[model samples]
Target: MPQTERPVSMIDPSLLLRPEKVYDDKPIEAFRDYSIDDSDPIKERVRRTYYDMHTNQTVDFVKGKMEKWLKFNHFKSTVKDALIKLNELVDESDPDSDLPNIVHAFQTAERIRQEHPDKEWMHLIGLIHDLGKVMAFYDEPQWCVVGDTFPLGCKWGPSIVYGDDSFKDNPDSYNPKYNTENGIYKPKCGLEQLMMSWGHDEYLYRMLVHNKCKFPKDGLYMIRYHSFYPWHAGGDYKHLLIDSDEEIKQAVLEFNKYDLYTKSAEVPDIEALWPYYEGLIEKYMPGVLEW
Candidate 1:
């Protein structure tokens, strides 16, 4: 059997970043109701992760954790069972969207489909983009499974919702080797050389890369770093990216606009859209993804 066919390990919560405060107090209603003409709720939620990330993340800490956890497989169970488990995790904290996790995923995908029928790859990307959220249901914490992803090789940005204030608690913040803007990296280096804070985005990206999925560059970028709002949206670490990275950045910029703006109160009937997505899935992915 392939290495990715094994079961993912149950992650330790102690290793995950902790939120400084509960986000439930924030006005997430506009985001939940999808009634906002302005305001980016997805960015807000992702920023909340940054708050925790800055304070709790360390170079050795995240590196050790990823080495220990990333090798594990997440595709041991059926996709249906995985989605069911993911729904349970969503239910624990997501009071806004009462819909099942699968339903929420389908809603996002269908919204993209309706807006751009020509972008069939995007429809599929939206459908499974959050599949990494299943990590929470599999015993991962909110920090490890979801959050704003950023490069580990440079200085944590002040604009990064959880920036320097939080990193005071982390040893790497003081480590000269990691405290610099180019910590552990050269100028204009590609993101592939940079390590991202551990989460579902990296997990799913790795799976797609390994499976050789024939997705558009934009779709692949969305999967790899949809949680990386700090660099993409906030312009926080643009200095670290090379020319090739900049081009890829431009491609995904369009994808992010659709992802953040397309949420709605009405849920998409998955049964109605499954055939179209399933065909796309079969076209791009193999009979079974490794994880």
Candidate 2:
């Protein structure tokens, strides 16, 4: 089925990002090398994390996680409360910012606020986008909750970060049935049917769905697929996208700029910023939500 949904009205959040984008964006004045590769310990850990993620995040693994996580019965908490809990998380998969996940949450949300002030849902999405990562602090390992996500059952696309050699160790890579392009999925099968690697993206997406969040689909799409580097950033997996995804793809791209490039030393004052976000949460997602 071609995912032919009506277009959503949302601002292009990426337009607000300046050309500097992120650190290690080659030619940056900063001497610190932030790009993911050898030598830098931070980037190295990120690489090793990706290697483990690519190795273990098989189709069955993702399905099992869905069975457990999609239940949304882990715990109950309001959106603001969940954000505070997320403060304890540090995404080992991210080579960019090492600050507490709470800081990054405010940073992303604040940037979106600057760009699209009227879109309170967008701001809220940025704030809680990685809230699912709190799963790391609970019981899940960093590998399962963080990193660039790609489809599990299909032939792993080449565009995934560290995909070529890193996935070589993955058991699925050895299986002839799963190694070919389009394995287990037909051409242009909409992403709705695909199983992305189990992580914050899917966790939070399903959480919102289970809670019956009132946010627009575009914001939901951004929350769900922000970590899908293979699809939105690398431009792979197009063969699998249906026509309706064109709208969603644009929203994801717009959301990506703020999510990826907004990391900085500037931290959002939790005290000062709490009120606005609280209202948005109350308006859109109030009360104790199922985890």
Candidate 3:
């Protein structure tokens, strides 16, 4: 797949995900080297949101949050309607990507289709992977809704984009057990034994698992942990994973090729692509996806 050129921005705050402290406390080199430019408005906005998410989320708070908000009532509308609302929110946040959320989904999915047509299941995964973002419409705060995801029970890595120093304020950071590299997990224990930060990825994974869809397990792992930079991109916390997680890890790595490489300005015609995706959804999912 070809790489998407990072868009330029006229505004002060770039809307891409990063931290305010990242700009203030650390050198620019400390941040991930993406193609995006400093002037990109979306980059700074994304940075502020990341700071909020990392600063506020505590282990126990996220756990209680999953318990309270994990029900299907959160997403009662059709997929199209949900996509429309999600796009509206994105529009308000970053006007540069004036494309609708559905457009983003179609772009990502169509790119996957063009690259690996044989992986039909992967095509569907790309389409709806971020559907759980509909949670934003339910009044969920942006901090809890999106940003980098990491295992809650394990040691938080300094490598995660936000200022790891700020995590000292998090209650879990004090728990002596969770502060270590291994934390609660044994070596190579696998990600299934881990609890990732509560967010859209896990919600969508559970939705697919509950429906028993024909999508590849690897694709599901991609949806579940794509935001898990600590393990995937940083190479931290691998010690906590078990042997079974190796399969899932390898699968996620495969999906990352498409995820990172597929974001391009060239978008597919939604009118033409909708039928294939709709059919795939009906074939795999039940009459109604609970949310």
Candidate 4:
């Protein structure tokens, strides 16, 4: 791994200034310049992931997964423990640099910490936002644990990654019940009632809710929909959302700047940073969680 020549504390979140700002110029250039058009290289890794997801993420598949993972009987882990363990996996769906995820965790936290130092809860949210992706570390395929998520039972969103090419293999793509816009859901059925495709976002959202973590609605929203690029980033799936959902959508959108933009070749000083995060963990979600 390449470390920045300057101290990591001065790392810029978005705007690149001096040449020394880039640890590896390639990913930073992609981060700064690449578009998500059909031809972009970012779509290369996303293609296979969405292909498998679109094919297998049927209503029945999501139901079966919800029954299993929703029980929250998987294992016991604290927030800190789970976030640290999340480092073991890499997100194939991510076009960003494939560093251990703890770097991203801290990178996100530090970015928020820099901008809104008073919103300590937001800082914690940034750090553990993708800790839900630990599902990949637990034998879950990269396709399921990480990706741009959309609702499973309803008609697929046009902005979903690989919107056309991938869903051809999906059974739901043909099933008349799921083919139409609105499918089984009523207009403005609300995101809470719908089952999103089984992924770490849903997993961690359920975990936090079940554990009774005293986080604000925004924090929870950031956790759940951070991967929901189709809804938040792509501007698709507005029919399913109610007025209140817009608040959460804005929160997720603001959170996305840090989550999507913070990837780099540089890593955080984990040893120096661990103590502060442990303190935050104790303050909020202390003790072993039945994750």
Candidate 3 lDDT over residue span 1-291, tens digit each: 012233321111112332333322333333333233348766666666665676667678777877776655554555555555666655222323446667777877887888889888888888877777777767777667666677876678655654465475677777887777777777777777787777778877877676566776687888998767667766667677666776877777666645544443467788887788877777665355566
Estimated TM-score for each candidate: 0.75, 0.88, 0.79, 0.85
Evaluate model 2: give its lDDT: 0.77
For model 4, how does the per-residue alpha-carbon lDDT over 1-291 read when each residue is reduced to its tens digit?
122432332122233321334434544434422223366666556556667887889999888888888898878988878887877877777766578888988988988898888999999999988877878766789888887688877788766655555688888888888888888889998877777899989998889999999889999999998887767756677888798988888898788778866786368898999899888888888899998
In model 2, the clashing pairs are: none
Worst 10 residues of 3 by lDDT: 6-15
Which model is ahead, 2 or 4, in terms of TM-score?
2
- Give lDDT for model 3: 0.65
Task: Give the Cα lDDT of each candidate.
Answer: 0.62, 0.77, 0.65, 0.77
Error of 2 at 261 (Å): 1.1
Best by lDDT: 2
TM-score top scorer: 2
Ten residues in sequence with the least summed lDDT for candidate 4: 9-18
Q: How close is candidate 2 to the true structure, as a TM-score?
A: 0.88
Rank ordering of all candidates by TM-score, starting from the highest? 2, 4, 3, 1
Residue 72's lDDT in candidate 2: 79
Q: Superpose all Cα atoms of candidate 4 onto the true structure and report the RMSD in Å to 1 decimal.
A: 7.5
| Model 1 worst lDDT run, 10 consecutive residues | 9-18
